[model samples]
Target: MVTSEKNIQMIMELADAFGPSGFEDDVLTVARKWAEGLGTIEEDHMRNLYIHRKENTGNKPVIMLDAHSDEVGFMIHSIKPNGTLRFVTLGRFANIAMSSADVLVRNALGEYIPGVIAAKPVHFMSESERAKGGVPEISSMVIDIGATSAEEAVNRFHIRIGEPGVPATKCRYDAENDVMFGKGFDCRIGCAAVIETLRRLEGMDLPCDVIGVLSSQEEVGERGCKVSVKHANPSIAFVFEGCPADDTFTEPYAIQTALKKGPMLRFMDVSVICSPRYQRYVLDLASEKGIAAQASVREGGGNNGAIINTALDGTPVVVAGVPTRYIHSMNCITSGYDFEETVKLAVATVTSMTPEQIAKF
Candidate 1:
């Protein structure tokens, strides 16, 4: 009945949908269906879906809200004569995370066949090999679909090379604790934020016209965002991300992104240094509004902001990262409160902005 619960349902469905870079049809379907009454929807050849808000006035300055729809997934590269599948990644995948994972492969018939990522039995490993100390190599990995041979896999399972695959993890929400566990939060959570932000702004008169783009192929490189920026010529942009949480691995003094924190606004990631003026505005606004937020200077990772900020002769951009743990793996965890706060901060920041104030940034 509450705002977070309603959006969690959307996030669950988004996370469950099978989509990878260049193969985001199912994810786009979930977004388009959710956007039905909220806007005019349009998409490009690359499967980037755009939601043009109902209250948008073309006369106003444009505010582009961006999130990638594609999750880190894999494509079947070949079927061994013995029936297991060899795969190549569509995006960055944790090598250890892939071994023994429950996965669903898209078949030639457009059906998903449940399978398990194969791994050598512990008993079969030599002590010397065990000492090597790292995840199994991709060449040593395969997806077993319970088939006897390559012919059976293709003929009966209808699976073939180039088909996409994603983790088969189901979504779970603990309403009492306000926590979410699932897969694909790396960006599906971001996709949900874009939708929720746009939905909240519907029917309200604002300083800028807001357009939400559920971009594709972000994990493969910010490919879809490149096309989205060309379509959305905006004066400013909000890049929402489901960023990695550092609470578990980071030292106490170095912790930047952590679960239960409202949102992690990054000053720099590997690809882009955020606009200082806009970043400062959000930070100050969060303080004024009592919205909990953390600022981080990431030593690694990238997002669509890197590409969008440099477009249309430069646009001011700030990335709001929702702290998520174990992202890009089979299982991920995020705080529902963090998600809600992110939506709140974004709504307030955009609504409170003015053309003159933006120019100063």
Candidate 2:
């Protein structure tokens, strides 16, 4: 088992890496380095990394644990006639929070340039405009890189259309409350869980080969998972992810799930409906083991449910997620306790699967 301190360090490191949709190379590099001494690691054509452990006889069907390596970010659409830069959203983002926020712009050569979202001062707005409230539209936002003119901006930064911009910051811990806040925890936490679980299972001689996929392009769609599943051809799969929840202000009992309670066993979502039998099996295991868990019926589509359910003509799929608060923003928060417990649950589920159990499904 990975020590608590080691797990925390992994989470922080994964969260600190920069990986927006279609630009996951940096994060993938870090993951590859971490998997070097662990086991045999392979990267598919889609750039999804599959880390595995040697299989044992009498093992169940191949089980895959999928986690996305992408996060929400922006792409430079054009360099304006002036020195300002105009960009479009690469993923879902709130314009209100984006305006005037510090951002990191990556050029074609992978250079990090500091910039900020520039907006009209509130004092210059009319009272009626102020009454209407909210920041201006995304199209009105401009990226300021401290250049004087268009010529000077082009000369110094070489800013071009289609560059990627991400939030500029690092993950930090709230020592007083033990809360860790940073960007990309939405699914990087999931990636860290899969990596750590495989590390924990080292030399266990487990049945059936287990594939850990650090999937890409999940924010735009489950594009990477579709290709990875076709290649792995696993008969059963589990997707490790972080689910959005607001339990601190909302009543925990009334809410769908709460942080630090353990993994949330999702029953259904828009992308894919979980297999009833597999869902029951996971829940039963959690109950028998007295592992903290909850059920979630998310309103929107998410996780690897879309591809995993349809892989290999049909694969039984389950999604285990850590409850994350304030997802898709500059700072997403989750519980360290839930993260550790989710890893435990995934390792147990994979190890407990048997050939008979898979065939019965």
Candidate 3:
């Protein structure tokens, strides 16, 4: 069994990898390496990694733990006449958070070119313009690469249309306070939980087959899970994710979720209504095991949507997520305690289920 420190190191490695929506190859490499010697691993055409372990062969319902490998990023659209690059967002991005942010532009040769999201200078802008609310439109945004002309910029850096650009940052751990700060924690944390669980379950005597899916294109709309669900055909599934915490000094009701509260057991989401029976089962398991957990009612967003109705012909689906702050932004934060709880909850929930128990749902 891997230690908590090793699991945390794996998560940090994943968070540092550059695997935006359509470019998940690098992240997959790391996942594949960690999944070795644990189970049967495969990568689909869509770049989704599926790791399966055949423990009990009694026709038990398959259980899948899903997490997306992609993060919010951008794609280059055009090179401007003045050497600045015009780019379009690949996934959801908070435009207000894009200003003055450093970004990494991945060229065709797999090199990282450093650039910063350019914004209009306050000195040149009128007070009225500065007072305008909300983020500026994409048309008004450009990436500054320190080039004086388009020719020089293109020659020095292979900036082309459709290349992926990600936030240029590294995962940082605060040893004194035991906090980790990083980008892409939204789903990376979830991915880490899935992988850690798989590693933990290695060689254990279990009653059912378990599948670990590092899904793709989730930030684009859970498209990768749609494919994997169909292929694995799991009877019961858990979609692990990181939910945005509403803790910016907001009102109580406005603060939808919070960190360090264990996994949030989502009852309903925008895409999928979790099976009542499975929700109860998960809650009961957490209670029985004395695991830290929180109940959530999400109106929108969760991967349960794709898993519940997509493949396996209406299988029971449950969502377990860690509360994250500033989701989809460059500085998403999550508690290490919450992350570890998510892993424990998933392992316990899956280990406790029997074929009959799963099929009843």
Candidate 4:
């Protein structure tokens, strides 16, 4: 089973998990469940999850496969007297697309309460507001959960001052098109790839020991990989991401990341330049193995790879990203074909990597 039914289920579950920056318990819950038999799982105080392969010999160099578990979301800042919740952005949400969107707020009781990001309706807007004709500031919006007063909001709804919330979009797959629609594809899809890659390499005897890290709080910054990298101390790393696709808006010749093309192998983004020799090696290997892959030179955007590349004596790292459209917004689209190719490319990479190749890089 190349891209098995379980793999698709895992992708949907990971993408559907309600996880925000600094609030990743739900995401880790799903990750651990799917990764049950793959390795010995351990988590940190900051909720960085590590999966140590059971076949590791402890004598070989460590290889780290990393994907963050957090997504762009909102955090409750204060509740107005009218029972409306004011919020602050967590990570980089597409604020322009946020008004009137459905969200699930995590209340103090650890339950998700449904809400809508409400803004003043057109009838209530002043002439100036209508003439200005621009998107409202996120600060001006409120999350309404049907409570009529602050007392009701707190006492009845259990809403608190610092709860996190994410888009209430569920995952849906189009089997005919091999596409997926959902929220939080920024890194959840990447998380699925890491898990599936580990599963594929389960019984193999490789030149290096591998560890899978479902890191946390990446949308806020590259924070989780800082800890995960130190814990794993890998000599080399493979970072996976659901990168923003440029196909929809970019010029015809400039499109590098497109849905259904393959996983993107980025040489450089805003954060860090990837290991050139290693990137070339993997691209060449993909060609030799006839695996679909895309090469990208991004103008903006970053990932856990930047942190891992500088973590310990500068580990050699490459990022294999699934091309996702409309990331950082409430909803996103990605291709199942891209995901499958990502897993295949990664599996081929680790299986072919050796100590000699590492020395050259």
The C-alpha TM-scores of every prediction are 0.98, 0.93, 0.94, 0.98
Which residue runs does candidate 2 get wrong by more than 4 Å? 1-3, 55-60, 249-253
Across residues 161-248, which tens digit of lDDT does each residue of candidate 1 receive? 9999998999999888888999999888889999999988988988789999988999998999999999988889998999999999
Which regions of candidate 1 deviate over 4 angstroms?
1-3
Scored by CA lDDT, what does every candidate get?
0.90, 0.80, 0.81, 0.92
For residues 94-131, could you state the per-residue lDDT of candidate 3 as single tens digits? 77879888899987677999999997877778777778
Q: Scored by Cα lDDT, where does model 4 land? A: 0.92
Tell me the tens digit of each residue's lDDT in model 2 across 82-138: 788888876787777687877888876678899998877888888876886848888
TM-score winner between candidates 1 and 3: 1
Ranking by lDDT: 4, 1, 3, 2
lDDT by residue (tens digit), candidate 4, 80-177 = 99999999999876667798899999998999999999988888888998886645888899999999999999999999998999999999988777
